[model samples]
Target: MITPTSDRGTKQVHDGQDFVEFTRTFRAPAEDVWAAVTDPGRLARWIGSWRGDPADGEVWFRMLFEGDEIPEEHMAIHQCDAPHRLRVTSTSPSEEGPQVWDFRIDLVEANGVTTLTFAQSVPDAQLAEGVGPGWQYYLDRLMLAETGADPADIDFDDYYPALKEHYRELFA
Candidate 1:
């Protein structure tokens, strides 16, 4: 069971055609959250296991979603600010040609609350649909992991399929 936190945030779908844009809010400070996302040590606690620095023009390693057993290809950091924004370019392997996935993250603070907005442009509709809940799961975990809590307690299997269907219904 997923117990929603008092500091919980929402994710909104911004575009449906060729990409998916998501915006979520967090209760932590921008700097702390940014470090949690950009720092390899901190990021491994929540998101997929990664390697290499998060500096601009750098390529990093990203493992698959299921576990760290299978390592994916490199993801290049296109642009980044210390605690404000980041842009990256990655390729997702598939039956067809690898699809390019461009991601942009913006950290905004208002009245002591920080909002992290993630915008992604995928090359295919199927990929965009799949990424919706996958991000939701990680972002929620990111929030919990930042607070010294274990985020692996929640089950994401059900939510992931449902989110993909929801995206299809909404965008179709």
Candidate 2:
């Protein structure tokens, strides 16, 4: 079990915009880790899935939950270096209005271990309380997938409201 209080760090980026960064190391090769992150089938096992054409300059991103239903949005891929780095931007409707957010993913290898780094700018500081653990759970799911664990074994309840307080304290 992962301690809710660990595995994540917060930062202020560019004019005090708050963001959260997460890093996880996989015992697999960088190529294998990259496939797990970018491949739609593998991603659906962990976080969300994509549907749009990348050559078209955009793609459809669907956020998969515990059920068949999902919430999706369009994301523009600003840059991608297969198996290494990706930068993307997307806007989604929120109670606070349409929010544009940035996401970056990086993979690096050294001495036979591969590390995955993820960073995203928070649209609202208060949301950090939820975002932190949400990503943590997803990354954990990714680990389970790469290890051949069943995705059905994952329970979203363990992340969201369950670990909300732990993340809230981090944001606080």
Candidate 3:
């Protein structure tokens, strides 16, 4: 069951900069979760697919968040640490020069369960409220794909304004 955003715990961290972190514990193994994240084939099921070797350093890839109508956003793989962490940074071209955000995915296993920590940091702190629900929904898709659930189709309407309001209230 999907819990209400009001009930979920999200924290803001600052190491001289701001970061929004979301945590989820899966009853699956760490390696399994890691594979789902690292493999482009599996990632396509939830978020967009990648086509690069992170080991070789910053590799560029296209991101597809919405359907075919939306243009793919060019993103780059910033870092990859196997079944432990995956870091990515993306710059969106705009008249304002470029908008950038860093995504960090960290995984750890203990007592047969794996815990995934997903975080996103940007220069503007206000962005977190808008991003909170988006990441939650994507992670939910990750859980569905990992658990062998049936064909999963994510609806943006189910998350956006709904959780966005919650995030705004909480972060405000």
Candidate 4:
């Protein structure tokens, strides 16, 4: 149900059972895109604060989504490979559910261009519907920041509400 903003397209999968996937092609090299996503310092510039080193079996800092100051204790890093792929696992603490969010980031290089594919698979329908727009916004910001440009200052607190409404209107 993600409302299309600025011609940025979105797609839904699995009757809302599978996680919403967002893909964008960045005009940067695959190495640079991968670094921006996997490198803690680079990631913080675009996304949020990241703690601990990124490695296999290492619990990196929880991503402070949009408005929340306290990182969710239920988040963790599952796997990471430089300039290629990363997988993260996240859970919702508000519910007594065992659902895990599997985020897979893949980088494809061809003809001096890079396509960054971000796929987040959540088991819950509600979460999937809500997360679609959030990821789109953040990834848009990430692309801008990587290109040595300042993205419009976005208030993280307003992200969820706007996205939720957008999703409902688009997919309703």
Measured against the true structure, the TM-scores of the candidates, in listed sequence, are 0.80, 0.84, 0.82, 0.73
How many steric clashes between backbone atoms does each model show? Answer: 0, 0, 0, 2
Runs in model 1 with CA error above 4 Å? 3-17, 53-56
What global local distance difference test value does model 1 have?
A: 0.67
Model 3 lDDT per residue over 1-172, tens place: 4443332436566456556677877897888889887778888877777666666665554456666754444567766778888887777666677778777889999988999988777445366567877777777777767777632565656777777766665566
Q: Which lDDT values do the candidates have, in the order given?
A: 0.67, 0.76, 0.70, 0.64
Q: Identify the candidate with maximal TM-score.
A: 2
- The Cα error of candidate 4 at residue 163, in Å, is 4.7
Clashes of 2: 0
lDDT of 4 by residue, 92-163 (tens): 454465556667788888877888878777555465456766787787778667777664555444555656
Ten-residue region with minimum lDDT total, candidate 1? 4-13
RMSD of each: 3.5, 2.7, 2.8, 4.5
* Ten contiguous residues minimizing lDDT sum, candidate 2: 1-10
Question: CA lDDT of 37 in candidate 2?
Answer: 81
lDDT of 2 by residue, 1-172 (tens): 4333346555546346566778889898888898898789888887888897888778988888645654477788998888888888877766777778888889999987999998778756477877877787787778778888765576667677876676566656
Error of 3 at 117 (Å): 0.3
The residue pairs found clashing in candidate 4 are 1-167, 1-171
Model 3 scores a TM of 0.82
lDDT of 3: 0.70
Best by lDDT: 2
Question: Model 1 reaches what TM-score against the true structure?
Answer: 0.80
